[model samples]
Target: MKIVVQNLKTGKVFLADAPKPAVPDNGILVRTSASLISAGTDRAVVGLARKSTVGKALARPDLVRRVLRKVKNDGLWSAYKAVQNVIAEPKTLGYSLVGEVLAIGHRVEGVAVGDRVACAGAGHANHAEVAAIPSNLFVSVPQGVADEDAAYVTLGAIAMHGLRQANQQLGATVLVVGLGLVGQIMLQLCRAAGLKVIGLDLEEAKLDLARKNGVLIAAKPDDPGLAAKVAAATDGYGVDAVLLCAGSKDSGAPFEDVAGHCRDRARVVVVGDVKMDIPRNAYFKKELEILQSRSYGPGRYDPDYEERGRDYPIGYVRWTERRNMKAFMDLLASGALDMQVLTTHRFPVERAAEAYDLVIGKTPTFTVGIVLTYGPGEAEEYKPAPKARRKVPGKVGLGIIGAGNFAKGVLVPAMTGTGGFDVRGVVSARGLSAQAMKERIGAQYSDSDPGRVFDDADVDAVVIATRHDSHARYVV
Candidate 1:
């Protein structure tokens, strides 16, 4: 099976051909039809891949500071390597995919062959043709829910869980920061719940799109008096809840802007990346309640609970994150909301590289939702990258798109073992990545253009470990 992976070093994209994953007894094998690219989480990932060593250190100054403190007790090189390894591991993109069940493992009941389902859990429900997903996280796709619509279920669930956390009543005023796909969906969900919604973002076009979708008030991120505008819209009382759906380099601190704008005792639900700085003055004065909205709710990050067969008692604790996914899908099936306008772009699996570049470039041409399509297939033999060097005596040609730390340290290094795959031509839009990868992997040539590497005859096979947006294009 071929999987799309990000090169942690150069931010170059690559396609890896590995053994087909075996289905666990509690999981099902899904032949994916469509997978959605989560731009926010993935964009942060691509940006990390483009950073230099100094930039990485600065990005994690807190970690660096902590490491410095530990280095006095531990060895300096040891702490640095530990941090490097943490950054070097490649991350899989896409947790939302709609696919047909090709096979089901024993103990997985209710689902059978040919059943269509939407899967959650990253890496398991990746942007690939086939995935092995645990039974508990898999939800059946109702006939009313189209494949494209079903692919967005996981994200919709995220918005749903945020709403549940906010506990807003009808006619309540709300604010959603970051009018990206997730924010936009939250706006619609808020509107459906009879809440007045205000959207915020840097892009006017996205604001305009949100306005069209029922957000009456859309404000720029840089507006000095933006919180005032939100307050004015709320009759000077402030919103009942503020949902943070934007991703940033800062720690996701809900006590900053939310504390000032929220009404006394108003709730703030954080769903995106933002730094959390608790100001005692504000909290003591207003008594604001800050809540973190986990992606999969209580089951999130619990390998034993979410991955293994250990579900919490349903009667005692209703609506786990997995249940939220079902609720969102059911809402879609019932026509309470629509996702057609949200999906903006579609690509086949082969054009995966272009998809990654689109996200990495942060292209303004098209911004909403993007989907990658895959046709049914078994383990297909990959034509070794054509441009890779096949006649280097014992060396082989390789093309890598992403040059992030993971690619540079692991994948690229793994490909360069003695008598193993030779690192040939490399492609990365970033000059630093291309140059750095060329040196580290001993590539015969390096180019900023992916086409140059793709078109090269010396390249044996392409290895794409770029961004989530590119997974579909390259696989096609």
Candidate 2:
């Protein structure tokens, strides 16, 4: 099996082979159809990994201070060595995975083999051809839900859980700050809950998407007279609640616009980072209720509830995070929510690096959600080269189809370092990336059309790293 893993401290990802793992006790193995790259959470992790040694130390000065303390007290360099060891480890990427169950382990019940399931967790649920996830994290996909739609289960569950925490009533007005993927999901969920959704973002493209999707209003965060517009939309009563879903390096700062526009005693649930300072005067005047929503429900971060076999008290808290995923899938299966507009791109497994590059570079074109795909025979056992093409003697030629920064920084570097493979060619929709890759890696040729790479006689293996929408086509 081939999996994409990133070094936790280096933000470097490599496509490497791993043993086809067996289903362990309390877990189930699934063949992945699609997985959503959680932009904010995963990007935060990637960004942390990409930070320089000095930057990391600056960010976590306490760690450095602790090491200094050890140096002064015991003359021990162990803390420095420990930090280096911690930096050397690799972290698995992804949690929003939808796939079919291939096998089940001992003590795993309720879900059968061949069942379609949405799996979410840190290490067990990942972007790979196959994953072994704890049974507790696997939620059955309802009938009629497409694999791509089900890929949103984890994120949808997150939005839903946050909404639940807010506890808004029908016809209540709500503000969703930051219309990223999660925020957009919250918008849909809020609409489903019969609440008014006012979407906020800096990008007109994102706000445009929200408006097209039926959000009550979409506006820039810094638009002058924004409070008046929101007040007019809400009949001067202010919104009943606000869900903060913005992500930034320094997101802890209060969104002054939200504080200004919210009605007195309104509930505010924060799902993303924000500078968490409460102005006593503002709170005292408004009597606002502020809350923070965790990623999963009661089962979140609980080893016994999510990782081990122990089930929680179901009667009191009926919907665990897994159950929330089940509810999300049910909503999709019933046509209550549509995921068609959310998925922006797809890439095949071998070209995974290209997918990461797009996310890192923040390419404005053809971007929304990015998914990595793997076909039935895409494992290490089979090469992605054309079956009809004859193998070249002494040359392992590769055809790369994505040329984003991630490819430039990590995967391409790894490919260039491969002992036997020759960087034969690359392709992108536009010739710019292809040409740049040709120059950077000394590829023999480049083309804007993928067909050229597919037809090239010298290419022995084709690596797909395009968007999610393109994955099925490339795989087929």
Candidate 3:
């Protein structure tokens, strides 16, 4: 299968042919129809990945800390080689997509082959012709929701989860700090919930669009009298909730201005990359509470819930990620929200680089919703994955069965320095951990099943890096 992959070292985006991803017993394989490129998220990700080693270290101190620890444990040469291996790998992009299920796992329920569904997950639902979507990350697409529209489901659920963070009444007002795609969707959600919304953004076009779309008021953060204007919008009640959606570099999101005029006890829900430098005095006096909205909802980033399909009881956690997706789809079907309005460009999978140019500000044109369409793709222009990491064939192919910290930070780095072993695959109890390890270590593939590694022809040696409790089972 051909998929879009970015070189971590060069930040060069292109199409590469690789073996079709295996559908887990808990997942399904889908032929991708359409996928949405998230401008804010994707740009930030690719930008960081493309930077020089020093630049990457400077940008991420936590990673640097991990490297320092590895150096301390394994010596300098080992740590350096490990870092090289990480950046040499390709990265998969795109997390929101709509596709037709081509195959289903025996354990998957309430879905079957030929059904149209929206899939979410960084590695699982990629900018590829095909995606292996886990049960928890995909939802059935209702009738009337176009593939492109449904591709916006992940972002919509993110916006919905942000608004859900704020405990509000129907008549309460929310102040949205960023008016990009997520902020745009948040507007529709707030309106659908019968709440008044005030919007803030640097782009006049976006502010104008917000006004036309029924935002109670919209203004640039630097606009004179912005606080007073927000005060006027709510008839002096002030903002009841503040949803911060600005990017990481945007240190000047008008939150301070709005903070001074907000109602007592108003909640602040942070959903984006903005800095968290709150003034103690103002918040202390207002007795306001600050909260963070995890991406999507309760099931996100939880291996047990997302990979193993163990759902949080709806009675306890009513609006899980899947539920949020369903609600967003319902709103789309009811015509209360439209993703087409935000779409500024549509490109075939072949032209994804052009779409990303606009996303990262390399092209200065006003743009949003760069949708990539697929129609019987992989004809030409696909190159065999450069330096196939999946199998070394006659070489010393090593398979790793754990992705815990010790494996990634210590043992893996030590092995890379040996220079003879081709790290073929990695397994983790948690799907994301395995995927993350694969990206960092340039593995052929990642899966929760260690049997794929043990049973493969190319794997000449296996490392039992998992917990000791599971060692006897694998060894036997």
Candidate 4:
């Protein structure tokens, strides 16, 4: 399999060959068909990563602090190299993808091989030939949805969660600040909920979709008379809620506009990366409430719920992440959301970098959404590469099977720091992560083949750090 990996330091993005990932008992192996590129989230990462070294350090003070700590512990040269390594860290991109289930875990139910499913997760639902998606992170695609449109599952869940945060009643009036992809989804969602929607953005072009999609009013956020428009649309009561869906470096981007146009006691739900510097005077008099919407919904960051498939009972939590995603799909199934209108560009997975160029404005084009298409993934085994082993006396040859965050950040570092083992090879579900870790630790080789390690007489021991359900299979 081939997967996309981006270099954080230089912003060099490329596709690299990797081994086919083993499916966890609580997950499924999916061969990706389509994936969505996020203008806000993915763009932020690429933009920040492409910044100068000083800019990168400034943007991430936590990394700066780490460098300082490293200086105190290791020598300056080693600290500098550590900083380089940190800057050069590779990240898997794309969180929303639709694919065909090539295989399913024994624990998986109500799903089978050959099912088309939409997957969501930072690393699990990536822009790759194949992804190992935990059951909770994916839902079967409906008959009505296409692979490209079904790829909107993650963003739709995000937009739906933002709407949920507002808690508006039918026919209630609301304002959506920023008519980007998520904002467009919000527009349709608000319409589906029978809510009166007002759309605001800096660019008039962005508001066109909102206007066409039944938004009562579409105008620039800075329009001096925007409050009057909102007032007229709401019958003089102003909007009942404001959903902030724009990302900006400006701390005070549209808060004043948001505050001035909102009805008294109206709530503000922030769904984007834009900073909030609520004008106390502008909003305090109204006694407005401020709410923050987390990504997707409940069960989002819960490892047990997502990775272990421990679903929250519907009786206790009405809308878990999976349920929210399902609602989005249901809307698509009911013909509420025209995913076609939302998608503007299509590129083969091979042109991923070019697609990103369009996203980052390097190509100077407007877009609501970009989809990366993939060919039917033909399963390929890991072909052994020529080996060069660092033979050291009295040292164990350690082969690792997982390159997840915990494994790379903790386990590998702990073992290597002991000066008693040579990291002979790495095998991970996502080959890109394994390759990165192998180069970082000076491993002899990296691939998706466990047999490379299991069959090698030089390998002294193996560490199984994959999902818990797969541990027994690894042991056997």
Per-residue alpha-carbon lDDT of candidate 4 for residues 1-476, written as tens digits (9 for 90 to 100): 77777888688777776666777778999999999998888888888878998898777789789778978987787677555555455778899999999889899999989989999999889899899999899998999788888999999999999999999999899899899999999989999999988898887778887787878899986678877777788888888999999986558657776887888899999999877777888777999999989989999889999888999988999999999999999889899888898888999999998998987889998888999999975535344467666657699988999887668766788899999998888997657778788888889888777878898777889999887967987774
Query: What's the candidate order when arranged by decreasing lDDT?
Result: 4, 3, 2, 1
lDDT of 1 by residue, 411-459 (tens): 7666666566666676654333555466655676665457776777777
Question: Which runs in model 2 stand beyond 4 Å of their true positions?
Answer: 61-75, 249-251, 362-366, 378-476
Per-residue C-alpha lDDT of model 3 across residues 25-87, encoded as one tens digit per residue: 788988999999999999989898789988987889999999899899989987886776565
Q: Total clashing residue pairs per candidate?
A: 66, 13, 1, 0
Q: Candidate 2 on 323-395: residue-level lDDT in tens?
A: 7888888889778788888888888877777777777764546456777777874444454433333444687
Candidate 4 residue runs with Cα over 4 Å from true position: 69-83, 379-398, 404-424, 439-444, 458-476
When sorted by TM-score, best at the front, the candidate numbers are: 4, 3, 2, 1
Candidate 2, after superposition: displacement of residue 75 in Å?
A: 6.3
Per-candidate TM equals 0.74, 0.76, 0.84, 0.90
Residue-level error in angstroms, candidate 3, position 134: 1.5
Q: Rate the local accuracy (lDDT) of all candidates.
A: 0.76, 0.77, 0.84, 0.86
* Predicted model with the maximum lDDT: 4
